[model samples]
Target: MSDTILTLTGVQADIAQYHILQGVDLAVPRGAVTMLLGRNGVGKTTTLRTIMGHLVARQGVIGFDGMDITARATSARARLGIGYVPENMGIFSDLTVEENMVLAAVSGRLLAERRDRIFAAFPPLRTFWTSDAGTLSGGQKQMLSIARAMAEDRKLYLIDEPTKGLAPAIISTMVAALRELKDGGASILLVEQNFAVARALGDHAAVMDDGRIVWSGEMSELADDAGLQERLMGLSMEGK
Candidate 1:
């Protein structure tokens, strides 16, 4: 098998009349986390969406596990072991936490082993097991979103902004859970704006600029070089 679990070459997409993802080239290595970092409006989310087939690519190829999935439906992609936790959380407001998990599991049941794993990682999920997802706090919702994606086994996870507006303590929880997921041999393509979380979880780093990946390297290398981070991620990325 190829070392890369996911690869995008010259991938381009359009949102209505506006063009995004001019030519995004990225690779998520096997059993590692690849951080997708960039300034706002730079098409980082678009890249992940395109990969999941939520947005069709206008050009280029998307390869996953040695298969070309560019024309595959979103559901087909999910069935192929690609989990997705989109930016909006994508949970039903009226659904209880248990119901949400049940729906995400695809098997219509959350198996004992997976349930235990998720509960151990995020204790709050168990605490509010029967509560409506809408009643939970933002951090809890985010946790549920992640757990939903992991409800079943998956080779690759496409996660967008897992810590966009979370507090320090909750972010730490997210960091820990993601670390566990990464350690458990899952290849992740993560869109995270929080540098600390990205640095902690990412094995590799890819930076997008103006709808294209401008830099790709080891996460440690990017963490150690402030100049490179500034040039690729922008001034707002300073001290982040």
Candidate 2:
């Protein structure tokens, strides 16, 4: 088996007349949390969508677990052990939290043991099991989306903007949850704008600019270099 769980080589995609991903090349090593960091409109989210097959790639290759999945449908990709938690949190507002969990359970990807593990990781979810997802706060909804993804017995996850619009306390909770998932051997590709959160949870960091990766290396290196952080990510830690 390959050491990398997911690989994207020279991937390119377009949305109607707009070309989004331009020769995007990335790799997710097995059992690592890799953060995709970029400024707004830099195609970070597009790259995640392309990998999920939500937006078909016009060129390049996407491989999962040693299989070329560039042409596969989104559902096929999911069944192949790729889970996606989109930026919007993609939860059904009308459904109760339990119903949402049940819906993901029906995917049949998760074993009972896996379900228990996920619930254990997010105790807040257990408290709101019967509440309608829409009625829950933003943080709770984000938790539900992540819980649903975990319900799948997937090897890789593409999580986009997980802390967007969340309060600092909620963001901290999300970071803790991701760290727990990583400790449990889950490989995650996290798209994050929050540098602090990324530093807290990511092992590897990739910086994207104008639809291409400008820099990538160990998260520790990226975290300590304030000049690079300011230049590539427009982040400064002096205030923090």
Candidate 3:
């Protein structure tokens, strides 16, 4: 069995005239979280978006579960068990929480066990199941976003900035939920700004700069070295 669930090799992408993702390479190990960390505008989100097929890569290949999916449409990628929780959270404000989850399910049905698992991780989703998603607080919306993706038995998850603007308590909850998700043996490629949260959930770390991966190794190695953190993620380059 392959240890890697996803691989990006020499990937390049462009947005209009703006060139992004210049020769990016990444590998996400199966059943572990790999944190993609970098400064703002460093193409971390672009990397995830490229992997999710939200952006067409102008060059190179994207492989998922031993198959090349570079030319696959976004929906096809999703159906292949690669769940994406974008940076924006991608909530449907007008839709009820149940409706939003139903849409995220993709199978057109939320199975009992899946629903139970989602609720166990995010209780707020159950609280406002019939309510409009916009009525929920920011933390609740983030929880819903994660719950929706996690509702299915996915082989890999690409989560971008899951805790960007959350309160500490909510972040703690988010961390706990993600830890539980990791414990369940799921592969995740996470883009997190909070180093603490990244350290907590990531088993491996990939640091990006100038649109390419500059470092890749165990998360603990990065977390344990403050000097290295300062060198790679300098004072001015610490977040998204």
Instruction: Note the clash tally of each candidate.
Output: 0, 0, 0
Off-target runs (Cα >4 Å) in candidate 2 are 109-115
Best by lDDT: 1
lDDT at 235, model 2: 68
Q: Which parts of model 1 are misplaced by more than 4 Å?
A: 236-240
Clashing pairs in 3: none
Report the poorest 10 consecutive residues by lDDT, candidate 1.
Answer: 231-240
Quick one: RMSD of model 3?
Answer: 2.2
- In terms of lDDT, model 1 sits at 0.92
Computed on alpha carbons, the lDDT of every model, listed in order, comes to 0.92, 0.87, 0.90
Candidate 3, residues 70-165: lDDT per residue as tens digits? 999999999999999988999999999988988888789888888887888888887888999999999999999998888788899999999999
Better of 1 and 3 by TM-score: 1
**Candidate 2 lDDT (Cα, whole model)?**
0.87
lDDT (tens digit, per residue) of candidate 1 on 152-237: 98989999999999999999999999999998998999999889888889999999999999989899999988888877776534
Model 2, C-alpha of 76: deviation from truth (Å): 0.4
lDDT of 3 at 58: 90
**TM-score of model 3 vs. true structure:** 0.96
Tens digits of lDDT, candidate 2, 49-108: 999999999999999989999999998888788889999999999998878877775364
TM, every model = 0.96, 0.93, 0.96
